[model samples]
Target: MLALKAENISKQYRLGEVGTGTLSHDLNRFWHKVRGKEDPYFKIGEANDRSSKGNSDYVWSLRDINFEIEQGDAVGIIGKNGAGKSTLLKLLSKVTKPTTGKIFTNGRIASLLEVGTGFHPEMTGRENVFLNGAILGMTRKEIKRKFDEIVDFSGVERYIDTPVKRYSSGMYVRLAFAVAAHLESEILIVDEVLAVGDAEFQKKCLGKMGDVTKGEGRTILFVSHNLPSILQLCKKGILLEHGLLKESADISTIISMYTHNAESEDIIPNSNKDVYLKSFKSYTEDDLESNLQTAKNGVLEFNIYSNKNLKNVKIGIGFNDDMGNRLFTPFSGHFQKMFDLSIGENTIYCTLDNFPLKSGKYTCEIYIGDNTETLDYYDKGLIVNVKDNFTLEKPDYSQGYFIINQKWTNERK
Candidate 1:
């Protein structure tokens, strides 16, 4: 059975200022409505590309997006930062109406789109739990039954009676998620609310969500930037780009496409005024540029383009899996090494030794700093691909991120 379905849904917003700045445009829409004709501005909406300005005054935040999610299935929504992710959630949650489409859902929905989304700040956490439960059409008896479970899961028992306005952001998300998850809603919508919580709490929340879907067989729609969490929780995934539904598939395939799109952009912003990074590259042992993927043992070189330089410069690079987990970071300070550069140009090199990390695409961060301050930093400066030079028999070898270097030997079983 289908739990939710969006049909030809689209949301359009007027550029600059609010709603049809001129009376003429407003009158035109009314005239069309009166004549039972299409609105004059309906066809003028441009695609939502924030990189450049458009000629039209209207742009579609989401255009003709269609998908259906089944009951008892968890679906993950993945997209860029401004890819209408929140907009779609808002539309589904009934916080706003679509400009031109319909969304169908089979059961009651409880949403925690943001911190304290459906919460009243002045109300105590205890009262808010009941209030949210009531809003979800739960009886006071039902809420009372789940009250202890909710408080235990949130780990905010001490502050349950305190007014939520005084609670920190993390506390707000904790209690809010607790209520949403424990309530008797058939479909739950969560939108990156776990990000505000601590790492331990985030892990707890993911575990609870897994139980909600797998054990109790509830439908869940989750939006998050944490790729690993999404992979663990959701079986199906959808990718959105510039307000359009680009791809829908299993979680792994969707993530692969999304990362490829991001890497293709190759965006490295130079926020440093003094020293700028011209190029960051990985090379083979024989000295060849291998940016995409290379063997475990290779060289990572950074070419610095500077107007002027000084002494005691420190550099470092960090490697992270796609899920934002830091595998390892090597800093020059580890070896008590520093460099002195000339006036116009500089080059820095970092080498790897038998790095048998599992074969997959990884992202690296480059930073240049002095003892006192940082001269340049790129969060995702480059994408490093590690190839599996030594293939193993087991499939888990391909899935593992880190390789064991120790040799295995045994006399008998």
Candidate 2:
């Protein structure tokens, strides 16, 4: 059975105004109501496109979004900023009502939408746990049963009796997630809250989320900018573009679509006055379409246009799978090398001897900085595809990240 469903869900917001707007729009809405007609303002709203400037004052943050999630399923919602990802989650969590359409859910939901969500600053950590639990429809007895477990998992036991206002941002999220994950709830909704926590804590939260769906058979709706976490935890993915449902499919396909459609604008100088990364591209030694065969050499070429001569500059490149998981990072500092970039254009080339990456689609992230200051960085710079060269049987995706050259022998007992 489906645990959650959304039908024709759309949220409209008036730009630069609170509530409806001027008295004229209000009167128009009231007149439509008296005439037994739908809200006239709904017709004037435009899609939530951020790239273009629109004339309408009202914009549909989410337009006609429809999807269903089965019980025990973990779904990831992915999109760029202003794509209405948070709006959809707010509607599902009942934190805000949709401007149009309905959402149906099977059981109680515990949401960790942001840092310190549903937490009382004046209350102690221990008290907030019980308070949030009670708000989620958990009885005091049930909360007490899981109280110690939550405290332990959060790793903030010493501050249990301290007021939440005194806690750091990390501590706030740690405690908040601990309460939501441990309490009894059939549906769990998490936004990018994990981004605030440390790496170890994020891993713990991911593990707990996996357990919540696998061990308890609960449903999860996760929204994260961290694609690796989403890919690791979610079996299904929903892509949103400009407040519209772009696609819903398996996690791998959705990730592929997302990466392929990402904006690849050339790096240009902005208000930030530092080293400028003009362009970056990757290709095989033969200058092919950036496609590499297994155990073959490749080249990563990039140009840096600097405003001032840079000394002791470090350049780094990261290889990531389609899901944005960092497979490996090659840094110039690792080789104890630094660049003396003169004021103008300087091109640097790095070669990958016997590329270890297996057959898959990958993207590049470029970083140019020093130990003291950051010059420039580009998260999505270039895209490349790797293919297998040998006729041997291809390994499954889960086997590993690379196909290494190894010699295998069997000895007689």
Candidate 3:
């Protein structure tokens, strides 16, 4: 059965650079409301701010995104930031109304868009639980029945009576997630709210989510920036790009496509300083150039150009799988050496012959640090793809970050 269906859904928003402009837009909307006329800006006949010098029109956050999910399917929504993942979820959760199209759902939806969402800081944890439950259409008797279980599961029983404003950040998350999980809704939609807590809490949340899918017949829509968690928890995947549904497929194939086609121009900066990263040129094999992707067990030679004399300068490289887990980290620190270069121009080269890694995608992070801390960091120093031609024994669990050649002998079972 189709638990949720979004048909030709689209959302549009107007960009306002100045604060005073909002009053004019509000008045226009009010006048349109009184006249029984539709908002003229409903149609997305607007240019993006990036392409135009000064254009005032609507920008589409989602454009005709159409999909349906069956009951009991755990679907992962994957995309680069600003790919309209959150916008779709918001529309589904009914936090914001869609500008066009319709959404059909079989049952109530419980969404955890952000930590402490739907939580009242002034209210006690216990009170908020009941408040949220009531908002989800639960009866007082129903909430009372699950009250202790929720408190115990959250591990916040000690502060259940305290106002949420006084609760620690972790405590607030625990209580909030507990309410969402135990609400017994037909569908659950969770965003990247798990990134804030400690690893143990994250594991607990993942385990609870897994159980929610396994033990209950509920449908789940999960959105996250962490690809590994998505792949591990979701069997089906949906990819979004530029507010459009790009593809829906198996998790593995979807992740591979996302990483390979990932681009940096989509990044929005929190500050101007964040947008201007320090620039440095790199080369390979005595050539002054960039872009390196070497084969497995092949030699990798590097040369870096820098103007300032860097302190505690260490040349390092690491190997990561498609999900961005560091499988290996090799650094010049192992050699107990540091670079003290002369000011102005300097160049250095290092060679790694027969690198110890199986065929996969890996990234090298270069750093220059002082004795106190890192002065500069370059995350994408090198992006390498390793290829191996020889046939090798594969492990039973070959999906980890690396492939190590380990000997195995099994007795008769």
Candidate 4:
């Protein structure tokens, strides 16, 4: 049985404004419709590529998307940031309507699209729980039966009577997630909102979601950047790129494609904002497979674009393990080398005598900021693959990522 189906769904948005278009464009759309012509702006939309400046005023956040979720299936939606993952979730959650196409879904959907979604700030946590339950079509009595369990799971019992506005972001997400999960909704739609919670809470929530699908046979549509958690909870995956359905397959296959794609996830799109990382490149210290070889000399280059000249700028680069923990991060300001960014372009290169990471896949983190404000920060600045050593067949990765070279010889008689 199909739990949900989306057919040719596409979402379009004007570059600057929220609603359909400006008055002139609206009049154009109206004029075309009067003549029984297709919408003019519909043909004007370009793909949702954030990295480049486009000529079109309209962009398709999602285009011609078609997919189906089987009943009781937990499906993970994987994509880069700004790749229409959240837009698709919002459409399915009915937070917004698609510009075109249809979505057919079975049963009630409880969505945690963002922190404190559907929550009224004036309402207390306890009141908000009931409010969310009501929104999910649960009777007051039904909520009462599950109320204690929800409270316990959230671990926010002491603050249940406090106005949710007074609660911390962490508290708000915990209560919100608990309410969504405990309610008897047949379909659960969760965005990357769980990232707001601490590690322990995230783990707890992941476990509950697993049970919701495997034990209770509920359907789930989850969108998250955390691939390991996605693999653990979802049996299948849907990959989207530039607002189009790129691939739909088992979770493992989707993960492999997402990681190994030739197009780099390292590049941050050019922003209309003040400044951002334009491109990141790992140099020619690659092995035979064109992968970054372990324990080899290399340079990481960053080309940053800025709308205007900036001062007191500092660039920080983090070498991270696969688990997203920074092994070490180097900061420019620490060396009293506060760099300057020209109005148009700035280039910074970080060199390594021997690449630090062992043979593994790692992520490089980049942050550019100044004394007062942050210019740009890319947590997954680069997804790096470290293969065998340039010299050794197998690099020594015994105790840690960094290898220390050593040698001993007999002294004089």
Q: lDDT scores for all predictions?
A: 0.82, 0.86, 0.69, 0.85
The list of candidate 1 runs beyond 4 A from truth reads: 19-24, 264-289, 292-296, 299-349, 362-384, 388-413
Across 123-226, the per-residue lDDT of candidate 1 in tens digits comes to: 99999999999999999999999999999999999999999999999999999999999998999999987888987998898898899999998999899876
Total backbone collisions, model 1: 0
Q: Where does candidate 3 stray beyond 4 Å?
A: 17-42, 46-54, 263-326, 331-352, 362-384, 388-413
Q: Candidate 1 vs candidate 4: which has greater TM-score?
A: 1
Q: How far is candidate 1 from the true structure (C-alpha RMSD, Å)?
A: 5.7
* Candidate 3 lDDT by residue in tens digits, 25-142: 7798789989999876665344222434544456777888889899988899987677788889999999988978999999888888887889999999999999999988899999
In order, what is each prediction's RMSD in angstroms?
Answer: 5.7, 4.7, 6.7, 5.9
Best by lDDT: 2
**Clashes (candidate 4):** 0
Model 1: how far residue 150 lies from native, Å? 1.3
List TM-score per model, in order: 0.79, 0.84, 0.73, 0.72
Predict model 1's lDDT versus the native. Answer: 0.82
Ranking by lDDT: 2, 4, 1, 3
Q: Judging by TM-score against the true structure, name the best candidate.
A: 2
- Ten-residue segment with the worst summed lDDT in candidate 1? 287-296
